[model samples]
Target: MNDSRSRWLALAVLALAQFMVVLDVTIVNVALPAIQTDLGFSAEGLQWVVNSYTLTFGGLLLLGGRMSDILGRRRLFLIGLGLFAAASLAGGFATSEGSLIAIRAIQGIGGALLSPAALALLTVIFPAGRDRNIALGVWGALAGIGGTLGVVAGGVLVDGLGWEWIFFVNVPFAVVAILAAPAFITESRRVQGEHSNFDVAGAILGTAGLFALVGAVIRTEAAGWGSTQVLALFGSAVVLIGAFLFVEARAKDPLVPLRLFRVRGLSVSAIALALNGGAFLGMFFLTALYLQQVHGDSALEAGTHFLPMGGAAILSAVIGAQLVTRFGTRAAYLGGSAVGAVGLLLLSQAGADATFAGGLLPGLIVFGLGLPLVGVANQIAAVAEVPHEDAGAASGVITTAFQVGGALGLALISTTATTRTGDLLAAGAVQTDALAGGFERGMLIAAGLAVANLVIGAVRAPRIRPDAAMVAEASAA
Candidate 1:
């Protein structure tokens, strides 16, 4: 293939790898009931199916990103892919819940490794210009689409085939990407030098800390925030993460370079991504509940309801890249965030009698259309200007922000909904009405988060100048 054709083909491979990883995040959700029934999972124990993956993926992401930099991106990508595929296959044959959960955790590890390497590869593959913008736009779009599509795909696969197919489905995609990757993707990593230490202690602390933190966040949905186990985990996470920061500051070569934060727009983008994650991911969770419980949609019907949102996200992501290329990341982020907040506010008005067309579609479409602008912009801002050697690290940090942010957002939103529902139920409200009331309050909080993202962008988002490589593209345009 010619160079241009090669890069685009490589992007397809990388994006496919990432799509499978992200799809796993939510694909299993629709099949949870089926898995529970077949595998004899207890009501309380069933959550581990999801939590195991979340905890490992979120915890190991930074380490995986850094490892990709230390090792080669292609090498790590393949290794992660192999691990993920194997785990998925194993999961397909799992006869017990424990075995399945174990396999899912392994899948998380694979995802943590694959996602950043795939993104880092994009940074190197496309260069810093219109091409990179478009590439990242596709990457950002898939990030949103994978989550939404997972629901639809899950419902289809589960209904048509079986729950095992969810795990089995990953193998073919993984095999194709693995076979094609060598032909298109180039191998790249940090240069070796005198200061190329790997910061073993920092890695241990950071990984454990993130694990503890994510674990605590996941538990908060089931265990109240004040529960002894949750509190202890939270405390441990704070202490360990604090120590990791301290160690990184002094290390000769840290796992996460302290200086990376000084990169223009990075810190601001990280914060914004976190808020963006909290708002939109929370919206998805609540929206799913609203569709199923209030609107009386089956799993397939609810997943179908998200099709508009998914379509809007894909369109917005393409437009967002153009906006970034023309206007800049700051402008796109601010405008997009504002639109997203409006979408959430509209969603906040849905009541028990809410119809899909009147009450849900508008918000879903607008919200979907808006946040991906932030996603595409945030992604570009986070990684575009960073030194090539740190591309993996930069991608890792950005991805971590989104995952951690999503976890935090979902926890807060779910808790709010649960509390409101409980209160309404106690006061004699019908189940559907109480559920709707709770969902409204949850969406309102999500809207508030989006507004906060807008405010942050306005206040802190820096003006990003196009690189020299982009100048020719700009002049041509």
Candidate 2:
């Protein structure tokens, strides 16, 4: 009984930490205009505020995951929390754009460490079956809400306190999480022989490859895709990625054991997760821009506009958890994707004259409902077949897909919207109307991606039965 109590407490602590990490990804969206005004960021340069964190977070995740398994989850989790707190403090005090961007990147590294360790700990604590399913439901719910929560918090902080408060806000949460972690969470390490050494070469190759790839994608806005600089970066990324794969195939203890991909569920989940991340992140960014730029809303008002969506996401996440237990992962994901696509299509109708009630609210609620279903379902499917020792690796893969896909998707959406806006300007349209048209086009693209996710979920995601162990345990109880 005491053990169960401890597990629940540990889960609360871990979920709180996870919320902080995920919140940072979108908290800045509501504060972007403020940050840009104060920091003198060019429109293109402003993207780095978000991408710097995501790039490092995505790049180092596999390394962080393996480190957690090798060193110990508790140790890594503590270390990560400390780094994150320190970085947040630095970010709050930043005097220049370079300093803030650099600090955010460090924070991402800390997140890369903190996130997977927390997730691996969750997986270790909850035995696979009903208990794990329930715990994950709670975890996914927190994750689903965290993004919207950030928007709300960012609005309040930026409006009431200052843009810097968004960074400052993390400090208290991190301190509390760090202080409370040791008591509730137990230490865990991979049970494999102690002689297993960290794969240094694989880490370097993988991190560098991902950073370069994402950098190249972001560069396409300024440097055309066929430009010499972009071509070179792309070539380097391909080579580095190829080398990483080769090393993983040969390394005695690889950072990412390529063997894990053999699991059909994990493989499909990774692909679907990438698509979902791209669409999800792009939608938030475009919508926020639409509200602030086109509708002439304040940051606080824009944040409040998202409240309905957040509520719907929370409700759908609970239903998704139950669906996972009954029908299976595939059905939940497919159904969610179809619903999300419809929502995106509806959202594409927003224009300069559109009202929040008639134009945004309905689509926002419907999309919010489907978004959590995809997130929760993909998360469960990604790690379902992973062994205990590789739990961290699986968690890392899931998050890496999310962060990387978000970065890439944001780049695509931004580039496409900018081009369309420029074309409209050339054709003699007013700036506001052109901007709104560009945003709507981006929404349509996002809808198309959702359709692709639905197809993948239907074709690739395998149906999963409840673990026999869970059934046996229930029968005995």
Candidate 3:
């Protein structure tokens, strides 16, 4: 094997940054209750703590990626690291709900700037042919593994060190990454005369619009879909997003070039990302809640039990990456998503008295297997078909879709499940049993989304590894 000592070290540093960003997703899951109680957040308000970060990260991703191209990835990466670390510290020491949410939003801005630059940096460092493929595989694996670690680590920390440690954990990693990133990696190319105007108006509209849309999805429990507040928010979301789209079409230098979607792989990958994010919402958030709330498991137990799912996901993700070279991206996505759907379906049937071993473990494992396969496939697909000039935008689309879809999914399906469960209980069903029904319904929604993702994968994604094969043939020649 060719020695890649320096490259491997670089990979380690980038992967640490990647893992830190992804880990932030579920690292706070076990601490939701603690945050809610300590901060005195309303039910709807609690979702904001999570959704605010996601919305900001998702909305600004295209801008962030493009900025890195212009400002330089290495500088942007370090700056993002510093900002994220500061935001994490601010969040950790939050004395009030408003402060925490504010810091979380800033953390998201930092995340948005960091993730794409890291990936792009990796893309530049890892040469084409086997090396690039191998690097991407490692990248994908770390993303999945990091998410799993978040759940387990979050549980342990929340129980032992208190909820603040969730944010505290990132400080050291950020400091290390900020210091090390510029040392090993060389700067990548930028477009010679690319348009430089950022869509500020579009940005404001998109962010506020997304917030409104997600708010409606969350407030369904209190106001119902018909309530004036819910209706108005949804309406505002539509109008604002629509305005942003209209503005983008006319802007000289659009924040996100609309042309990226023309690539088939980019479009489908973005959709797949959305489904992937939705699945996480169901798997990590709802699943955690079911084990804790209805099943009455301790937060620690709830977090610990998710290990199987993460384990399966990591293994399957690696398998999925290998399969991509052999079978193609399409097959990996279709097969992996279907397997995950089955897992979600199985989990949807949990009862209040169900044991983890007999009831949830099998499903968790199956779902876990599906996660990595589908996730990595989607990431590979996003950047594969597009030209190098548009790689960042294409990448942005994949991640943006993931966040937007996740927020929508979590807000909508979770609200539906919660509303139905409350209604059933109000109608005289047993409280425990009704909660079970809600959890099942929510899981079913996510499962259906997964199946739909498979459909999109089969329809739009290219199966043959034309690029990989061509690289091989060229080397042989």
Candidate 4:
């Protein structure tokens, strides 16, 4: 009933909601084989099970954030949570590939609403100081661990229960969060202001443009970058985004105020987080491939290997909070990025004959440790200096940056690795050797991206004032 206990409880609910959303991002990967067997999905068609959710989630995030600012955060959070739970329940019973994909898309819509609203709530709930930094560290840790845990959980569920249990599992967590949310979390929106009309045109253009952009990026995995469909989508995205920017400049009220970009912390953090996300996801993708295809690990075995990663990230998050508290976000982020680059470089040394302990484990532990450091610092930096009214929009940009960047990075890494494998195969290499070589190349590319993150952090990162910005009213309703 007291303010302090209530805020922490509210965080627990929000973190649970966010963890569920993040879990869905990767939980379905391990279940894909089971899903294909049951639903008779074509190899190509099955990829959409993952792509549909990511693209839709990435595309609609900005709109969701703006809507949160217009509507209430608590209201949007509850609505999104309800939609997500219902879709997950429906997805468990899907008899056809089409039905499952559609449900996943709906889940993505829920995520777009829920993710930003939840993050914005954190920004508003914890004032700028040590408490907010600690809160964000917990958030970053859970988010990082969620991806790893998804694989572990998916493997266990798919092997123990049916694949449907993966979807079924979300229902109980969502129900608990939905029930507990209103008791602790309070409704808040952008303070009442003049020119309150929503920017419908900006919403349409911006959402459509982001949708097209993410679509083009996703298509690049199957269709080459130069393919007609990919090019057309890219062109459409460019024009629509250009139009959206033009409209926002002149609109009485913008869906996302252009001025928000001027916030040094938010802008720099978005870019840095994008690069960090790229490296992080690329590492995970390549490692998964290396473990399964190269080392002959089963899905469940590979998932278990990632448990160390989750553990390392938890410890790193605690250290990251201290680093941010003592030094600042910039110092912590730069340090983390450097460590991540080193981790990726170590992973690049893995060979066809590599043993898990000798080759893979060290890199996995190091990368995991560095990941949450970058994550926690960016989480704080992104919103620490943002105005109260635009907290939702700021959260949206940060998350969209990470998601879209991961998509782009994965595409690039996959292509590079595939091309390298093809080249090695042509040169008379064995299948496993070629696969290992390809994975090595991919890890190297990820390392390069991590190094790029370090450069961005060192050069462009904002020096955040710990006690300024991000304080907002948190009165209980």
Candidate 5:
């Protein structure tokens, strides 16, 4: 019993670390304008600030998690944390756009190593069953809340302090996580098979492939789909990705064991997670811009308005966790998409004349309510069958899919919103009102994607007991 208490304590610390990493993703988003103005960035290159971190982190998650299993979760945790802090300090001082983007990319590498290690460590610390469910519930809640927390805090800090404070804030989180690493969480078994070695070529190919894919998508807005540069980039992505799959199948100790994909729930949950990442996160990027650029709300005001959305996010996640524990993983997953669709439908009606009280607030709240369920339930579903040996890789696959979706989502939606707005304004529409109309159209498209998510979940939900298995694993860990 005493041992169990200690495990929970360890969970608390690990969850805090997870929160810091996830929160950084959205926190910087709210500060983008400030960072741009202070740093003097053009619109075309500005996205690299976000994309650099996301691309690296998402691209290398599988490798990081696999390393944690081989070396030591605690050791890697500290390394990743320390690297993140140092980079943050460097980034806060960055005067040139190139330097800032380079540092952010390095930050992504740190996050890739840190985030999955933290999660895999939690899997090791928590015992299986009911306790695991609760532990993971807490974990899911923290991650879901982290993005919003970062936004609000970023707003407050950027307003009072400066954009640099956003990066500066990570210093404390990284410091505390590093300090706490040695005290709690005993090292787990390293090396899955007889020999453990990283596939460097595979890693390079996969990382380069994903980066190429995302780069192509981002370039589409500038170069057009038919442009030679866009075509070559996309072609390179396809070939590299195809090579990665062939390499993984033959590698003795692949980063992601293909066998894990045989798990039904993991595959379905990951696909659903991709949709969730693409549509939901994409929605946030678009809405934040609409409120700020079109409406001209101060960053602080925009952050304040998001309080409702954040609140709804927490509520839905907690509720979804309970539902997963009570009903079933598949049910929880399907229900999340259903609820999210409703929220997106509510939000799709937003227009240029939309008021904070009448138009945007309801949709934001509704959208928030459904957001957590989409994330928490799918996560549980994905991890349930993950054998202790390959859990991290499985989690990485889920993470990779989601991050890829998120990156593409944000880039695609941003381009769509920009193009549509341009077209409407060129048609002699009111600059303000027509732009508002473009935002409305964008939200509706997001809603339509969410509806597709619902249908996919309904069709694909498999027979499984994810919560029961998750709790069992947590309690035993």
Candidate 6:
């Protein structure tokens, strides 16, 4: 058990934990109908099963990251794993919709703690260079693959073993990760004298603001954007967020250091990551609907259909790391975004008459191919120049962007599709045809968002050679 071997083993454990976290995000999606039917969930209430997780996960991410820094990455990681595992078990046994949603929210809190801690641990363990780059590539690929695989696995599990299996499935992975983690992950925390107290007000304000914001976004489709409830949530979010910023600017030990945004790479990459998430995640949600609703595929069939997309994402992630190594982050971001947008455009043309090969496969493959390029590049850029002590916070910001973006993206795209479907149905179109029309329109919006990512990356992301001092440091290690 030499140092190098130990680090690699730790990476494996961390990645496994991450895969579970990512998997849960979309795994429950395919099981939605089943869960709803079994529990007698209202159409509106059904969305909460997913939204509860996203809101809590997104809201607590910064605090989790900060806790990892102040408390100890390994300690927070274990605690998170334990909590998540317990919640999953409870969810499996839940007989009521309220109980399930509560359990899911608890799971999100665990995820918020685990995800950033795992990423920060990786950044701590792997020195910057080819090793770190490769590790991040694998992590990014898993992020993409996990979401897609969730859809596939969800369908299989729900159809074969029932929807409860979705939660039950996480138990084994959590147990393994909890047992293996202590052996491989060494404890690391910020210097003791750096900060005397945590920024409690900032944490409360930020978390509450984010939760409100995401809740508002989630309700927009059902309540209408201008509804009183939605408007109140939005106003509260703005005020709370503004107050959080004010607190951060004045706090002695800020939850999120305001100065971190001074790093060009971190700021730009965060924005790009958000936009990329909006498009990529939105694509997944809409495509799944198109396959199941429009194409009339069963859960298993729909899951199987996503296999190519998952495979492509994994393959492209490997290549994406190399692209970043050779051409730099800017080039990789630009190239990936351009290609991904094109893929979405192709998907936007899908209709009722379109076949799998003729309609969906091409875009699925292309979108999958392009995802990792952006994903890996954005990841590298986000943490490339971060100070070691703030790695956890940085990781939190990145993860938060992805979670919040996914929620917002799904809400907007789903709304677009729903509205379009209503119009088509009003015009006397068949159900399948109306759904296809809605999906196509939604895909087009997703494509535009991807293009926006390309523009942002080109304008703001700095070009840094992979062989710079960071890689040199890893090579020396």
What does candidate 2's lDDT look like per residue over 323-424, in tens digits?
A: 766887788889899999999999999888899999999999999889867776777777777796665567667768878888777777766777788789
Model 6 segments beyond 4 Å from truth?
1-12, 40-45, 121-141, 182-188, 384-392, 468-477
Runs of candidate 5 with Cα error greater than 4 angstroms are 1-12, 126-134, 185-195, 383-390, 428-431, 468-477
lDDT for each candidate structure: 0.80, 0.82, 0.79, 0.79, 0.76, 0.81
Give per-residue CA lDDT, model 4, range 1-477, as digits (tens). Answer: 239888899999999999999888667766776787889985445645765676668767777766776788888999999999999999999999999989998998899888878888987888767777667756765666787789899878887888899999999999999999999988888787733666778767876786677567656656778999999999999999999999989987776677888988888877887788778766776676678678977668778888887788877865666667778778888889988989899999999999999999999999888887776677678887787766656766777777767766765675678778878999999999998999999899999999888988888888753432221111000
Q: Residue pairs in steric clash, candidate 6? A: none
State the TM-score for model 5.
0.90
Query: Which residue pairs of candidate 3 clash?
Result: 313-368
Please provide, for model 5 over 1-477, each residue's C-alpha lDDT reduced to its tens digit, 9 standing for 90 to 100: 239777877887787778888888888878887787889976546767887887888888878877776788887887888888899999899998999999998999898888778877886776565776677667766765786777788788888999898898989988887777777777774646733777767787988897788788777767888999989999999999899989999999888677888998788877787778777766776676677767687778777788888888877765765677888767767777777777777776767767888878988887787766666667666777778656656767887878877776666765666667777878989877766766776677677667777887788766455535563332222
True-vs-predicted CA distance for residue 67, candidate 1, Å? 2.5
Q: Any runs in candidate 1 off by more than 4 Å, and if so which? A: 1-12, 29-51, 93-102, 119-141, 144-148, 180-190, 194-196, 217-227, 383-392, 465-477
- lDDT for 69 in candidate 2 is 81
lDDT of 6 by residue, 100-189 (tens): 999999999999888878877887999866777778757756766787778888998989999999999999999999999989989998
Q: On residues 45-117, what C-alpha lDDT tens digit does candidate 3 reach at each position?
A: 7777888899898888777777787778777777777889999988889988888888999999998888777
Give per-residue lDDT, candidate 4, residue 58: 74
Q: Tell me the TM-score of each prediction against the true structure.
A: 0.84, 0.91, 0.90, 0.84, 0.90, 0.88
Model 2, position 205, has a per-residue lDDT of 92
Model 5 residue 153 lDDT score:
89
- Tell me how far the alpha carbon of residue 83 in candidate 3 is from the true structure, in angstroms, after superposition: 1.4
User: Could you give candidate 1's per-residue lDDT for residues 120-196 as a string of tens digits?
Assistant: 78878887768876776576556667877898998788878888999999999999999999999879986776335
At residue 163, candidate 2 shows an lDDT of: 91
Q: At residue 101, what lDDT does model 3 achieve?
A: 84
